[model samples]
Target chain A: MSIDAIHPDWVAVDWGTTHVRVWLMSHDGRVLDHRRSDQGMGRLDQDQFEPVLTDLLAGVPPSQSLPVLICGMAGSRQGWTEAPYVATPCSPPGIGQATRARCKTWDVRILPGVKQASPADVMRGEETQIAGVLLEEPTFSGVLCLPGTHNKWVRIVKGRIVSFQTFMTGELFALLEGQSVLRHSVATRGWDADAFDIGVSQGLDQPHALAGALFSLRAESLLNDLSGTAARARLSGLLIGAELAATRPLWRDHKVAVLGGNDVAQSYEAALAAQGAVLHALDIDTPTLSGLRAAYAHLKETT
Target chain B: MSIDAIHPDWVAVDWGTTHVRVWLMSHDGRVLDHRRSDQGMGRLDQDQFEPVLTDLLAGVPPSQSLPVLICGMAGSRQGWTEAPYVATPCSPPGIGQATRARCKTWDVRILPGVKQASPADVMRGEETQIAGVLLEEPTFSGVLCLPGTHNKWVRIVKGRIVSFQTFMTGELFALLEGQSVLRHSVATRGWDADAFDIGVSQGLDQPHALAGALFSLRAESLLNDLSGTAARARLSGLLIGAELAATRPLWRDHKVAVLGGNDVAQSYEAALAAQGAVLHALDIDTPTLSGLRAAYAHLKETT
Candidate 1:
């Protein structure tokens, strides 16, 4: 198919702290082209974003002024352009609340992050993912678990985010495994299911002793000759277990839809299953694309 | 007094992971001279320890084979010489269990660390301090809390270390303050008492929710405009409170003696007081020197 014959309907972008991903969608709801780069908001200055983004969209036809919808950290004050946060107890912000970038070639709009004032929580990209979920299953109302560097647990009632909480699980794990004394005991790569389960149980049962438990991993290596693989698994389990213990109220009664990458989502699934909670895993990419699609449709109708 | 006229009786050293501290003691039990350097075990190889020690002791009179008693990481498996650990449920290892260093000029003995087989815990330098605690009060029986990078909570009964637990409170605090995203919301040098107390109460009340609570600090900074100083104080309080919550069984009914640096010990004292526990703070330097003195006495008698 010639580029001139088949014009892209719109473009979707997920700009995070450390990465940038872009997808071109056909009018018939088909993925035409996809590209990714390390040129994320975290690595770009205000003036640098335009050039980097322009380079990413170089493959697009010169005449095609397709509407590009952006989400995640790109909307933060420090990103491409500030897209003010949309308060919760509301549906995800669409094109109506999006901020426009000063670009001539592309009609670009950046999605706003979601903020909860009372508990003081804010999310940029996950809110769009939730919107994607609501688009696919408009009646889907329950808890949404999005695991990443900073994992988010969201409650949805009648297709709107009610309240949410975030955990420093992923960041804490990275710090412990990479920088803490536990680094000496755990391997950078490996896992042990038994040790993981044991650590999870301990974390759930007695979270106040987390600091002590973390130290024991190192002590066990020196004393009982514990393996690096087992140590890694246990460290992950301990962190995830503590997160689960804290979010019990969110998952105890409601069925959860986990939106994350494969490994992290599986970990959460295993943990939630142990808690006897029903959960379905969903790949983060699909919903993010769907969310961008939904926002594009909204833009078409509103404009 | 001239260095030639007043010869030192023995040298006491506390060589930890990050720093080397040494003190010269007289025959009359008076401190002759004291010196410190950044030549900790963590920064050097096995071969470098002797040279560092010799340089630190260059001021001493020549031809004097001064007896040197050392404790801490300098005796770890990877240290200057492997000082075999003394299995716990016993008194701190004295000269009998001390390992001799292959030194030509100085008669050096490295103190052995204490290890617990079950539950897998170990302590190197703190055990010496614990022995020092016993030298002054032979019948003191209670909990001794040592706060540092790895905080040790020791159980003492009739001048012997019965059991103990290690918490990574200080290490965790340092990591969060220096590396984590929470670093942006915490001042490097400032504190808020109210925020600290509030964090302590919350951490003690719901330690399982610590990960969530930590995130809230960042959120509060963005949403509710929480101060960096307050956030820093609160972060410290939460970690300490969680540790206190875990060690409640050890300190609830018994009087606690906190042996640590001034600031850290004071923090623990405040946390313990809030828990309605009888607590006293002791400077770590005194007990460390005393322990080395006691070890030197044992060395003199055994020889």
Candidate 2:
């Protein structure tokens, strides 16, 4: 809590669509102070990005003109500055590809995102997270499944991102369970492992019956009084199962790492485990922060 | 225009969730005067049904106490009158099964819906549509593909709905286009036949790639300057192709009737036709009206 003791070396920011998290770092690679605001890249106009960051940093007075390393959607086209994506079959982008943002108060650099050319895939902030993963296990070569609104599955070999694909599974689940007609049938909060497992099984087994499977949830609720909790779990299972149906086979025998500790992430863990996948998992913030820190260190070394 | 010349014997109404469509019928099965309103079953309270119908019929005064035969969501449990579902492998319900709603001005009959036991499927308004199809072809023994918000695929054997499945394709399309992230990429209007065909081909050929396929639309738009019009059409094609993947196998060679002339229905027709389906198309209102008239006549003959 002693702000005077923290003459921070630099700052790390994960300025995504919904939130902007700032972390003041000490010279010893430790987080001296961390704060976040709802003023994400989504909330700010092109001109407001610098001011927003300035306001977000007013509390933690970093004595020196520190380098402000930003990641996530802040590098997107609609973001504060367009950090052009570095294509696949390459290592996670470092400061070499980081795009500089014009700011009066600080040296700001936004990390570049990764993109796949053929299947047309792109990820902005997740690239930093991948860089963080590589920091922990530099030679970690396999697949990384990052579950979120737009779930990303990346393939890595010899510390380089080979190819990746994005699935709107999380967003689809939210829309279907909360906004769609199935909203009437699904519970807001509850879990049933059996129901989820059954759903996953159905999703894996029935490739041509997704529409019917979705309708069946409503129908079962109507006909046999299927509980809302079960329906919710079942809905989750169905989506994850379908996602696995798309991605699991190629990596069934490979080492997979699922990120985060949320219920959705756990659901994926269980699903992948159900499908005979030995998953290596990580906590939520470790990778993003690590990636940012790694980027800062790499920048210093290269300079 | 001539409400005076039309002495209606009965009234037929398709009061679905969103709109109330009323047809004034003569004793000889002529649609003398027809009217409709936005006061659908979804908007009305249990008590409001009578008044809504009364308001919808205020202009066209049928001379006598008309036997109002209503179908669609008006028969749902949440609707005006709860006309419970009749299990599959039976002809569409008639007066014997129609639940009479307590109305002072009219003898109101809400027809029962059809339900499947195994896969757990139900249809309210769509059953009436199916019955209407049967009215046109009494000995119909094929699959009926009714494309709508919840698209219904019914298997008809000896004029009975033996089995049926419902898909949320239309609803999903609406959500993905208007509400989801892909909304940024998808055009509200325009068509590209080539894009649609390619999407359809992908949906049919690649069973394990829906999520990637969907995300590709946005990525392509961002990375490859994929046009919005083509994206919209491609979106439609992908959904229809997936639906076809689920259904086309069983009923590919079966005599198929695609009802309605909406762009979505036409897309389905094109997709089905692409998959070698020689489709039998029908104008929208005929089958529904015929189904109601046939029900009325059957009610009279049985009485």
Candidate 3:
């Protein structure tokens, strides 16, 4: 089909704190077009979301009122609209339970975030991705290690989320590398496996010594001329090792399904493999697109 | 004596990364005048150190070629003149081995920082404080916990520093509470002991679970309406608890003497006490001043 020949049946969005991603879908579930923008929840006020969405879709030829299914921080209380969370021990909410945002020319549905009451936790866009995972494999049961800025180690029993924990590992790494004194020692690129292994081992062996271990990076840089590549890898390894140490209960005896971006997922895979665990890597796009499709399907049938 | 009646016999300086503290002393060891400046090592170039010191002392009446004993980052590689490290398992460097900076009117000696070759660690100002502590007690031996921006837990055997480790706990706490996502959940002031104890206990128990525990602060804030005071205390307890978990070998069996500003030192004392560790709280100024005195005495006898 030519660029302007076909019209999108629906739009799937993954809006987060820093970026917004959109996939234009045909009625038959094919991706017609994809778009991205930096106008995320962190940058927009409540009333500005619809206008941004309109602008993003301006290039697409006019069609009948398009169905827009959005997931992620856009559903947060501080985002476009408050799509109150669905408590855990339950299935991920779909179009039937999603909150609706008023728009002049479109029917917009935002998937609700997930919440855990006891320990107090929440997940926005990951829940949709989880739904996508579930759609891909209905019988899969194990721990899902979703690596990202706020990494989520989710425990899935059958299909429902039993429990999950979030780690500030990725965020912490960025802050330390970009702002802390360790920035001088850790390089922005080129990783060393041996250094990473050393860091992981140290972190796992003396998890409590993390604060001390961090300072060693700076000292080593000053005294021993530790390269940035080595420091970067080691820093990653240390944090992931500490995370794995704390999360041993989730993936120790059971097989784990690693999900998320390739680089971060590989890092987790390596760390998990070091512990002698069975693992499988799943492409992140599969679940996210699949979850969005599932949500669209639900919206079609329900309303 | 009136404020301007007595002239300083010598000057003692404790220059750190963020602040410079000067003590003008009489011949009888009395503090004749005291001044502080924001012109710390981090702020000044190597040449600026001499000029800055001269400006800070311009107001005080001068004596002929007064002796200036300097410690802290002023002795670091990037500070004034690099006072090379004295390796561990040795007494803190004395005036006999101090580095003389090129100053026109003052006899300035910068105390060397301490380094541990094996673990790759170093301390600039704390070593001087350790010396002061030893001078006061004369026969004391154990671990000295020095809390500050970068906290140090030093293991002392007899009069020498056997080994020491540094923790970025204070720095981590500041970053998390001031810059990270947890900032919104943690209060700038006020504290809850129960929350702190809970965080500390959880940190010690899981040691590896720290990264996850941090995220819970934000989660609880959203889901449970957790108070900011509670989150603040909990965050502190978690970091300190993790430190304690790592340093159990150093302080579990041996008594610890804590030296730092009032608030931070108290936090460590509480955390340590909860672990059944005996601790003595020493005023921070006590050891810093005493250490400078001991170094001055060393200079008097030698030079």
Q: All candidates' TM-scores?
A: 0.94, 0.94, 0.94
Could you give candidate 1's per-residue lDDT for residues A1-303 as a string of tens digits?
333333578889999989999887887678988889999898899888777877777757644267889999988877888898889888988889999987767787899999999778889999889889888788778899988999999999889899999999999999999999898899999778889888888888878899999999999999999999999999999999988888888898787988866787778888788878888655446788889889988887877
Which clashing pairs does model 2 show? Answer: none
Q: Which ten residues in a row have the lowest lDDT in candidate 3 chain A?
A: A1-10
DockQ of prediction 1: 0.81
Q: After superposing candidate 1, which stretches have Cα over 4 Å from the reference?
A: A1-9, A61-65, A103-105, A281-285, B1-7, B61-64, B281-285
Q: Write the per-residue lDDT of candidate 3 for residues B72-167, one digit (tens) a residue.
A: 999887799999988888887788778998887688889999989878998899988998888877667899999988899998888789999999
Instruction: Output the lDDT of residue B112, model 2.
Output: 92
DockQ-sorted candidate list, best first? 1, 3, 2
Name the weakest run of 10 consecutive residues (lDDT summed) in model 2 chain A: A1-10
Residue pairs in clash, model 1: none
Q: When only chain A is evaluated, what TM-score does every model earn?
A: 0.94, 0.94, 0.95
Clashes of 1: 0
**Location of the lowest summed lDDT over 10 successive residues in candidate 1 chain B:** B1-10
State, as a TM-score between 0 and 1, how close model 2 is to the true structure: 0.94
The number of clashing residue pairs in each candidate reads 0, 0, 0
Error of 3 at A147 (Å): 0.6
Name the lDDT value of residue B32 in candidate 2.
74
